[model samples]
Target chain A: AQSVTQLDSHVSVSEGTPVLLRCNYSSSYSPSLFWYVQHPNKGLQLLLKYTSAATLVKGINGFEAEFKKSETSFHLTKPSAHMSDAAEYFCVVSVFNDYKLSFGAGTTVTVRA
Target chain B: GAGVSQSPRYKVAKRGQDVALRCDPISGHVSLFWYQQALGQGPEFLTYFQNEAQLDKSGLPSDRFFAERPEGSVSTLKIQRTQQEDSAVYLCASYWREDNNEQFFGPGTRLTVL
Candidate 1:
């Protein structure tokens, strides 16, 4: 079985400040991790994905995530926050060669001006 | 150039009524998926299709939910005798192929059952 846990339900950050959204995973096989962002009334957009490549992955909108197999964590981070970044973020996990993806509860990000 | 698209962006059905939601995946994509998302939660997988073949329906909540993709380009999810609990956003996603990890999502259809 594979699953993902998003640590924070909501996170607030001031503009230009760093942002961090934590996630942990449990999977029996080598896992593929991903971060997706959903704006209000919009579809989910893939921010980044890790497929056993480099431990550090960069994504769209200047976002990045580090895959730490030891910690069973893949936390998303951004050096600076912007107002447009406010949205719901989901942590997702799927095992290698598997099509089914397991999603986390999601974390709501609010960027302050 | 267009992404995954879904029709009937919003729908309302009375109890015991049947409803159908549609999805059109990206051109040439080989995999399509349906998911249900409740308020304030993440999307839950409902079913999966690979080129008109219904490969997985394990996530569907009940037998009342039926999905089909005849030509491999468009798919429909039909719900029978909808209940209030069925009210939620239904999302559709697609993968270019089995080897791809990224799945493009559609705007989703909001279903309200009264």
Candidate 2:
């Protein structure tokens, strides 16, 4: 079985401040991890993915996450927060056994000026 | 050049009514996927198709949900006798190949069952 856990249900940050959204995963095999963002009523957009090639993955909009095998964690981070960054972020893990992807509940991010 | 597209951006149905949602994948895409997203929740996988073959439907919540892609280009998801619990956004996504990890998602159809 594969599953993802996002530590925060909601995160509020002031503009220009550092942003962090924590996520952890559990999988039996070597997993492919991903981070996606969804704006208000929009569809999901891929932020980045770690397919075992690189432990440090860079994504769109200056966002990035480090895959730590020892910690079982893939946490997204951004140096500075922008108002447009306000959205829901989901951490996902793809099962190597069957190619099915599992998503975490999600973390809602709020950016304040 | 266009991404995945879904029709009936919003649908309001009374309980027990049937509804059909459509999805048009990107040109030449070989894999299509359907997912359901409840309010404030992440999208849950519903089914998957490779070309015209329905490879997986294990994530479907119940038998009431049926999906098909006859010609391998356009697909439809039909929900029969919809219940209030069926109210949610139905999302469609597609990838160039089954082995590809990146998927392009559509805006989705918001289904509301009263």
Candidate 3:
């Protein structure tokens, strides 16, 4: 039983301001975590993944996420928001036993001008 | 060179009609996955295939839903006696066997059972 929980359903941020989307997980083993972004009418694109490697994982488009084991969280962040960053973000977790992936409800990010 | 691809990007069906969706994984990929996504929700796993073998289908909603990847590359998902609750976006993803964890997704087949 692995599960992911995204704290925010929708988040709004100014174009030039910093952005953060929170996510937490519950897994029985050391889990592999991933962040995926999906633009409107488009497929999901991988942002980053943490596979028992680095705790701080950097991804495409200047985005990154920190895997905090003690806190049971993996929150995505970016220094500055861009209009193109507006999309749906999903936090996924895969357990060590199986390749099955568990996904959070998803967080919709809206970049304001 | 191409990513995972799916056919019939959008489809509308009558309540009792039968529909089939197809998927073509990236060349050489060994794993394929099928998921269903409802509005304002995350994708839910329906089935998985390793090569031509249908490995796991524990997430399938009912017996009416069936999937096959007989050739190890191309796959199809069929739904019989469709109901309104079956309306959702059906997503297909693929990954290499050695790297089965990170999957590349297709644009998905949007099915609307009316």
Candidate 4:
């Protein structure tokens, strides 16, 4: 079984400030990691993915995540927060390229003006 | 290019009522998936379909749930005897077997079982 843990339920940051959302994963075997963003009443949008190609992965909207195998963490970070970034984010994992996705509880982001 | 689309963006059903949700995947996408997202929680996989074939449905909560993709493009998920616990947003995503493993998603159908 594979699962992901989002360390924060809600994160509030000021505009133009760096944003950080923590996530960790546990899997019995090799897995693929993904970060998806969901605006209110919207579908999940892929932010970035880690297929073991690079330790550090960059995504759209100035967001990025690092795959730390030893720490079992894949934390998402953005150089600057945008008001539009206020939404829910999920950390997902699929065991060994399996299509089935196991998502984290989700972290709600709030960007203050 | 159109992404995945779901009908009845919002649905309200009384307990014991049956509901059917539709999903129209991106053209040429060979795989489709269903997921359920409860309030304050992330989405959970419900089933998977490849073309007109259902390869796996292990995530379906119970026999009350049924899905089909007869023509290999449009798919439907049917829930019988809906209960209060079934109130959630039903999400549909489609993927192409080739290229990256990314799945395009739809806005989803929010089912409220009152």
- Fnat by candidate, in order: 0.79, 0.53, 0.74, 0.76
Clashing pairs in 1: none
Q: What tens-digit string does per-residue lDDT give for candidate 4 at A5-35?
A: 9999999999999999999999998879999
Lowest lDDT sum, 10 consecutive residues, model 1 chain B, at B95-104
Q: What interface RMSD, in Å and to 1 decimal, does model 4 have?
A: 1.7
lDDT of 2 by residue, A1-113 (tens): 98999999999999999999999999998999999998876888999999888899999999999999999999999999999999999999996545567889999999999
Task: State the displacement of the C-alpha of residue A102, model 2, in Å, after optimal TM-score superposition.
Answer: 0.7
Candidate 3 lDDT over A1-113, as tens digits, reads 89999999999999989999999999999999999999987888999999898999999999999999999999999999999999999999998647788989999999999
Q: Could you report the Cα RMSD, in angstroms, for every candidate shown? A: 0.7, 1.0, 0.9, 1.0
TM-score of 1: 0.99
lDDT of 2 at A91: 98
User: Alpha carbon lDDT of residue A15, candidate 2?
Assistant: 99
Q: Which consecutive 10 residues in model 1 chain A have the weakest lDDT in total?
A: A96-105
The two-chain DockQ for each candidate, comma-separated, is: 0.86, 0.64, 0.73, 0.72
Question: The CA-based lDDT of model 4 is what?
Answer: 0.95
| Model 2 collision count | 0
lDDT of 4 by residue, B31-79 (tens): 9999999999999999999999999999999999999999999999999
* Span of 10 residues, lowest total lDDT, candidate 4 chain B: B95-104
Instruction: Provide the overall lDDT of each model, using Cα atoms, as 2-decimal numbers.
Output: 0.96, 0.93, 0.94, 0.95
lDDT of 3 by residue, B89-110 (tens): 9999998964448989999999
> What is the Cα-based lDDT of residue B47 in candidate 3?
98
Off by over 4 Å in 4: none
